[model samples]
Target chain A: MSRWEPDARGRLERAALELYLERGFERTSVAEIAERAGLTERTFFRHYTDKREVLFAGSSALQELLVDTVARAPGPATPMEAVAAALQAAAAVLQERREHARRRHAVITANAELQERELIKLAALAAGLADALRQRGVDDASASLAAEAGIAVFKVAFRRWTEQAGEKDLSEFIGESFAGLKAVTAGT
Target chain B: MSRWEPDARGRLERAALELYLERGFERTSVAEIAERAGLTERTFFRHYTDKREVLFAGSSALQELLVDTVARAPGPATPMEAVAAALQAAAAVLQERREHARRRHAVITANAELQERELIKLAALAAGLADALRQRGVDDASASLAAEAGIAVFKVAFRRWTEQAGEKDLSEFIGESFAGLKAVTAGT
Candidate 1:
């Protein structure tokens, strides 16, 4: 087994999702994932700490992207506007990987433990966005509310985006969902 | 060892919280909790499926309260208004159990697994609220957005309510949080 495997990370992710879908997440093993990827278990360990980590490997990166976008919003932007911009930025990134996002959503939706992990990731992203807002001088209560509301929009929009045919962009759904959130909150 | 234990449920809950606080949730056992409460493990099992269930015992009742409130809102009430009413109703219930809620919050905050469980419960509550809104003729997207936004407000308000001294009522905090939510979403 050569140590210099090309695109091992991507291959491992694809293999893991395929196995997770073919056999339930609970039934799939790291060894099988490695083998299915034409790689060694040692290489799998090098890429991810555990089988579960394979499914969640992108979460931290996504959170960082959200926080960065929030921090870099124009100085005069409102908290919700900043949050909306960050969500749209995320939507743009997700739009480039629509198939992967759909498959990953399916895998997470089929398993309770995965769903819990997904919730934790979303919660952490909200916290990160709130921290970014606070750094921008938004008050604590408002910062937290805007970030949470933003994540709520993202969740709804992302679910709708993944469920629909590939006609509209994820960013459009995000924009519409944010508008929907505003309408509902406005009691309209 | 009698089967007819008085206040067994309450005793078990208090005992479980105490043990979880003192020894941590991972170290606490059903047998120890039962012993602390002066009941047997059988009584504990009868009341709760596991040690973790002690902290979440009220979730279903809380969800029912929220759903019923949403369902019974005035015909002309907006989705957010109905959600706000449901949240206020829940706050009123939690107001009476401030100390218990505080301690439980402490225990759950200290543990990752409990926090995940808490997130799952909140997600379920949001789903229930959305369903209730849908039943009230709200559109699917509007119902989900309102429910998720409502839960986000509840999370922030409940946290603030628990963190502060009992000078203000939970319902008041709920009202303020909903206003804050509207303000942020309105981009004020």
Candidate 2:
């Protein structure tokens, strides 16, 4: 029914990034985004709760995916290993979404408020991973420690992944960063 | 020379906490905070950036203190030991401000937006510590890992320190958590 003909969600996200990048995030409105997408304001609302939500549409899903990945991880793995596996799973999921990921990253990095929201979301994801580890009988301190380490690894890997071009892989970067972080901290 | 005869900053902090507890953060403004503190808007701005800032005035100072503590630490200490020393240093700088810390914690907890800002601030502080460690000749990735691990230890210890009734020393709690995390990740 929409003129753009792309999947509604993708179209909405595309419309949002264009607008948010052109005008600052605080200046962009939902109606403007809807118009750009060739979709109705109603459809836009259906896709996103508000202008800010457009900036974070995938965050909730990403958190859920991270938590589920941790939950379903194979038993017998150390907490750090379990988290590394979950991050690898996440990288696999994110690999196909490079364009979208880069767009979101640019938007977030350009705005302090959005960056703060993004950090908070990552913190929530870290907390969820810790909780999942705790559910697997890891002690609270161990769970949080491993979870925070996982976040550090993920962050460094994510930065590396986005900084490069080509068929470069997030999982590979994450694996290297994990090894690097371990080496960085090891035998000390 | 300031209004309220002495320690205008303390007076503003107290007044702001009162207002924030009575009427949530979003509803409070600079004028209201200044008025509650029995000072003018100029005085308020002189002491703090804005309403949200009054609660976080100590964080930058805390970061500087921690960084200095890490930088001045004897080079022979392991990363964890160095961070532990910095954390104990924080306890010394922070203990006298316990009431303000509790008030700020309550305010930050009450608002998701504030929590985001707080997390970002913590992330920045962690990065600063990592950079300081790197300056001490710690390798890059390991510096971050140790800095983050130290943050984890501080978080655990601070939580315990805040929960206990009066007479609980924050330094001891920090030491305990430091030992605990080192034990948890000791062989890993």
Top TM-score prediction, candidate number: 1
Window of ten residues with lowest summed lDDT in model 1 chain B: B1-10
DockQ list for all candidates? 0.76, 0.39
Error of 1 at A171 (Å): 0.4
- Report the first chain's TM-score for all candidates: 0.97, 0.92
Per-residue accuracy of model 2 over B44-94 as CA lDDT, tens digit each: 888787888887777889899889999999979777667777888989877
Best by lDDT: 1
Q: Chain B TM-score for each model?
A: 0.96, 0.91
Residue B1 error for model 1, in Å?
Answer: 12
Writing each residue's lDDT as its tens digit, candidate 1 over A1-188 gives: 24589899999999999999999899999999999999999999989999999989998889999999999999999999999988888888889998999999999999998998899899999999999999999999999999999999999999999899768999989889989998998883
Superposed on all Cα atoms, model 1 deviates from the true structure by an RMSD in Å of: 1.9
Q: Comparing to the true complex, what docking class would candidate 2 get? A: acceptable
Q: Which 10-residue window in model 2 chain A sums to the lowest lDDT? A: A179-188
Error of 2 at A114 (Å): 1.3
